[model samples]
Target: MTRSWRPWIAGATGLALVAGAGVIWSVRGSDPGSGCERTTITIAASLDHAPVLQTIADGWLRTDPRVDGRCPDIRIVAARSADVAANLGDARAAGGSAAPSISPTAPLSPSESAAAAASAVSDASRRPTVWAPDSRAWAGLAGTRPEAASLLAPGAPSVALTPIVMATTPDRAGALEGRITWPDVLRQIATGRAPLVLGTTDPTASTAALLTLMSLADTDGDGKPTAAEIAGPLALERTARVYAGSVDVLAAQMSPGDSAGSAPGARVSLFPATEQEVLRLSASGDAPPLVPLYPAEGVAPADHPYYVLNAGWVSARQRAVATAFLDVVLGTAGRTAYAAAGFRDRDGTLAGLTSASGALDAAYRGRPLPGTAALTEVLVRWRALRRPANVIAAVDTSGSMTEKVPGLPISKLAAFRQAGIQAVRLFNDRSRLGLWEFSSDLSGSRDYRVVVPVRTMADQVGPVSQRETIIAATNRLRPHSATGLYDTIDAAYRAVQGIWRADQQNILVVMTDGRNEDEDGFGLDELLGRLRAAKNPAKPVTVLAIAYGSGADVQALQRVTEVTGGRTFVSRDPADIGAVLLSAMVNR
Candidate 1:
């Protein structure tokens, strides 16, 4: 099938099945492979494979006699584990009337990862016959499957499981007397009593990383770390680092006996089971001495599960292979393999598992991590906490900005003036808006004067005055001097800094169509550094940037936003300026 049709089919099927009974089932007819004819089946494995899974794969192929001549050919497609959900989605869209399949070569993009899991149950063409994810938490994404309750016959085997553990340096573990609690760990990092270093796979992309964060949030009794919490004294005690991209990169950087001055160095520790496997390598002399820390507050294990796609496209032969494979993986041998990989074999012992394992088992099977929902709620709350923002609109009114479009008679300056007027009109009354146009020299010679300070102006009063002021400022802004975008933004930040309140959010909305050419008491880097360090220290301020036309250092604006958790929008169309500014204000 064509690539275009694939995603459409997957998305449609997953949505249909999930919205309906949650459990998707394809009618079974006479099995195509009933006579014991062999067929090839592809397995899409996630990137993070626990040791137990590898062991099971090795043992299963060797022991299964049917595989020698009679059974289906099992072709393994080693793709990034995160892509499995998306692949399953595509399979579902293709319709399960026939056995589901996927293009092994296809990989998900960054944005695609967000919808991958959901699309699996919702998409039609991308569904896979079977999906072995690193955590059962993913099952929730499939929606409620009541049919799953009745699908199991008298003696059905269970899915997969993997235990999560913390990996730390032996010296670090010794400081805590072998075991540690989450609170104590946080305290040590906060108090500088112990040099705390922890690593995890990327939370945005890795299921393991997400689960680990969820577990920590549960332990903290907060959904997730607040911006304030992340910026707290603890993070400053040492450099709180985020090893984005891959765990292997972090592992390689932190592996002992390697260079001590590398990015994270070998002293860094990792949390969760995947890292524990790395620790095992150290124990075996393949790496350095890495200790596993079982937090005293309790430990949580990852519940890895293998799910079957019940879309309409699943053919008789594929269904048979899927069933047979599930049986092989979840059966006695499968459970043993999981146990060998540090996971508790609780296939037939859920009640006993919880009763005996206590907190660890609770973490594995609990209904959403305790603080996850709350943490997410808090994060959202914090998003708008500093609701009414105080922004200074620093516009570059350089001579180049007056250059007419190659064919158009209207100069860029006229377009900017119109855009600035529209932007001022769109300003929220709750927001204290000001206008400052600068070129080689400050247009009005008022270096840092408030055009409109913080106050809820009536519909016609404040906004009208602000618009008039902006228009007058633009009219008087002669295109005689060079652009000092950096200097203007710096002065605006300082001006706004004087009126910034702890409870209110302060923002510097800078619109520049050119680079910093003139006025330079302080360089761009120094000015940005001052802004970064200029936060009230009690309340944080964010900087939003809008790049218009061309050659306007977009990267510089993005850097400012990244450090402040703000955002940057680029637009060549002058009309879009107002909407972009409004979006930044609302988002801030």
Candidate 2:
């Protein structure tokens, strides 16, 4: 949209207001009255490069006001690449819903028709005119749909490049330097013999995490993988080992001291992150400087792409302005600023700050990203193939849960039972699962009663397998007595810890409603103390608590999860318990 604008001079000094130390020189000579109007272009870009892009945009505005009647007023918004991709996908899905059905009996006037067309343009323009995502995978994802495809301009050029890497202390990097490949990292973790503690960001959230999975899946020399390769048992096992919850969790565990190397006490010894992230962390001095180790195989670099949208909201003039904005980003000054912020040039070559930026070696090259279909396949495969969980499910049989769910005829307990069965199906034969129904007086003096003991699903009974037994027992669960939330949580945590295996993602999945009602059991203070005392760094067991219905004590649940490394999932509507349980079951 074009807007009447005043002359706004953003000097190079504005660049310093952002992250990283970059010397940005502004382009001058344009007066405020030089251009009649300006087209405001909003670019939703990855968090890493948004500030630098703004700097470039500022320079472009000063250097050249209007290329063809429309001056550009670029506004850069920070967003995750995956989020932007998801938004585009959602917009495409909703494209047709906004159209009003016109009856033939009443034709609109010309003015009304113009208003309707403008309204349509406004709806389309609600989305960003330009999207500069971290990797080309997102662009590949957006191209699959007609609505999203219409928004994309051809030939999106890479503005900057940063390879995903495994960063650790110098000692760990030295140890694994020449010997390490993508599979080896997973193998080391599976064997519980990794030279350093391995971790990665959440695949669902971070493109780097998914790429890390892709690298492991790329068994052959070629970056592309066949369905057969991804479905193989070994590949799945490796991917499971590589995922260590989320990046925030990993970052929290990192040692803040410079002297802290790959010691036993150090939370994370090795993590997969962008090179720029590693530099940022090191620069902050809150953590020790990490030494990046490139894998023996190829790497997937986040080649930030500038895509000028071809949507109805973006006029021909706006398109030209976006192209001009891209040119400025690819120009010499833009390259220098990116180099200062620890990014490689568009050609995948190292920037001027070789030593300061910990530049990648010349041999390191960018690998081709998987196609849209294959990438989608790999992500779906990852969910199923992830580390088999050792879960002790505490299904609350509290009296409150007996009440019927809103709008649905089924009771809360009934919904949970069905959901339990559905969630159990997500785990495979490799997983160890168990069921426990908790409420006061259910198991004679205890607040919790173990219905099905935790055991490997592969174990054989007299006739049926252990997995079938758990499913059958879960379906038979019934609501009974008062909620013994705190005591049951303590018992489950202790029980899961007893059988904790370093390789497995040991967890206590507590599905409950209402606060601790066991006056006879230990109070919240005592339970919290006990849980804190039960903490074990080497063998971690996260508590995934699901607070079901309005009566569910969310505050109490959060307190319980704080002691453990797990999180609480709330489903206020009992109708959504099934979906919520399914999501909570996934490791991500």
Candidate 3:
């Protein structure tokens, strides 16, 4: 484990992982070559700070820094902060597995022993010798995952900082600039009171998203979002179109000119992103400048912390190099590099251009992140809420779907099928779901055909499972017939009502691009009549209909949903289907 290395450079709210071996950097700088083995130290950084870290690494290389009598080879790569912590956890798990077996195990020969040693080194090589996540929150988050336990070394010093914020154009910022509470916006959208559309990256992978959810759901001052208040924000997932997976992409999509800050795939009015991103977007680029909508409470500043891993694989010399490199990062060189990259110094002061950066114009106030336990609670509650749905998804397979959407490259049917599969994937095994494809005479005299039967998602159907069958069926579906919207809704609604599990949330979802064209089947009036007549108070089936493309009859879809006390969402652009499908399928 004593691989020689060059001088080291540079890790979070703090998921306070169990204390590991502490690193103390007090060594003097040595010459370029130490006549020792050449070692490479990799720093896996969050997207925000990866570039800046590379700058620091480049400077360190010039100095030909040496630590513990070994020259260091520093490498920096962009990676999710949570992933690095998880990898460390996995590495420790691997280390445990690599340990020699006891009892009946036989001694390995020369060739066999060399092969085993090579496997061990290969695993160690893949893991970053140094982990530099964007925020302290990641450390706190890592504490929640059992496998990531003790993966981060103790005393990870905060080097640079940036707050999590809602980024929007200057004009829009005026309306949303205070202690911006997100739940209120979500509730307004859910109840049909507001026309505002906001976008966010996936919370599971993005720290900016996770911290925003933590803030949005934390209605009470308890520092954790309770189930009671979290429902409002939970709808953010359903209306299905609000998710924008990246800051750069969302910023580009949301221009000031697009009068309607509509579908996330198109443009959103507001988006949650890192402060540096907002600054970078506004400072330059064809995209409009963005301002911050600071939460009424406070912001979770991404505190770039430096962690010297205490894992068994990180030898004394590697730890020494990591520790020394951390010193370089906190010094004048590191601080200067980070500031040049639009990050704040360890102190509250900014590096000029504060107004454009979307901070409170030289007024930076950041609150301490919650404890690991509190952070873990928020995640657990989110996982508990964003799951287990009972749905009857009906997709329109009309010939009209064969035509490509105006603004998108893919055909309407391709986008529709993708959206359906994504919505079903969001559901868990505990839920019961069914998939149906509809067109003119899709099945002998019937306008709809059951691709998958309603049952527990995990249930097996002959050779195919419920989840697998729906995905496969939707992919195999083609478009060559006419729309039969009315009858399909009636049948799916009745199907949901028939099984009617009191324990689960039951709802029927309809995805269509056009109005009813089947003269042989029931009309819109008859369909609504059947739904109204068959509606039982005990077994309620809410209809969530998604009208894809411009051809959809909004009035007709609206009337159909109103009968079942459900809602209709219109996706004028086929590209918006995935973003719109989740919010449509998931019932509150």
Q: Considering every candidate listed, which one attains the maximal lDDT?
A: 2
Q: Local distance difference test, per candidate?
A: 0.49, 0.68, 0.66
> Which ranges in model 3 have alpha carbons more than 4 Å from their true place?
1-37, 90-95, 98-123, 145-147, 177-179, 184-195, 238-240, 261-266, 284-286, 351-360, 391-588
Give Cα distance to truth, residue 217, candidate 2, Å: 1.3
Q: How well does candidate 1 match the true structure in TM-score terms?
A: 0.47
Candidate 1, residue 569: the lDDT equals 86
TM-score of each: 0.47, 0.57, 0.56
**Model 1 lDDT, residue 349, Cα:** 36
Q: Positional deviation of 570 in candidate 1, in angstroms? A: 26
Q: Residue 555 error for model 2, in Å? A: 50
- The residue-by-residue lDDT of candidate 3 on 1-588, one tens digit each, is 121323221112111111121111211223435565556565666777877776776677666655765667665546556444433343344444432111101111234223222222343543556778887777666644444556665667988887777787767655432345566556554565544456777665567777776775565656755434444345555543556546777777776745444534446777777777777777777578778766656656777887766566667777777778889898989889888777778765686425544345457575666666656555554554455667888888899999987777889898877777766666666789888889978788899998778888779987978888888888998885888888888888888888788877788888888989989888888888898899998888888888888899989999988889989998888788776675554333
Off by over 4 Å in 2: 1-35, 89-95, 98-126, 223-249, 256-266, 357-359, 386-588
Error of 1 at 402 (Å): 44
> For candidate 1, lDDT tens digit of each residue in 382-490?
2232235566777676778777754567776776676566445444345566666667645454332344443432334545654465556666655656777767777
What clash pairs does model 2 have? 7-32
Clash totals in order: 44, 1, 27
Model 3 lDDT, full chain set: 0.66
State residue 341's C-alpha deviation in candidate 2, in Å: 1.2
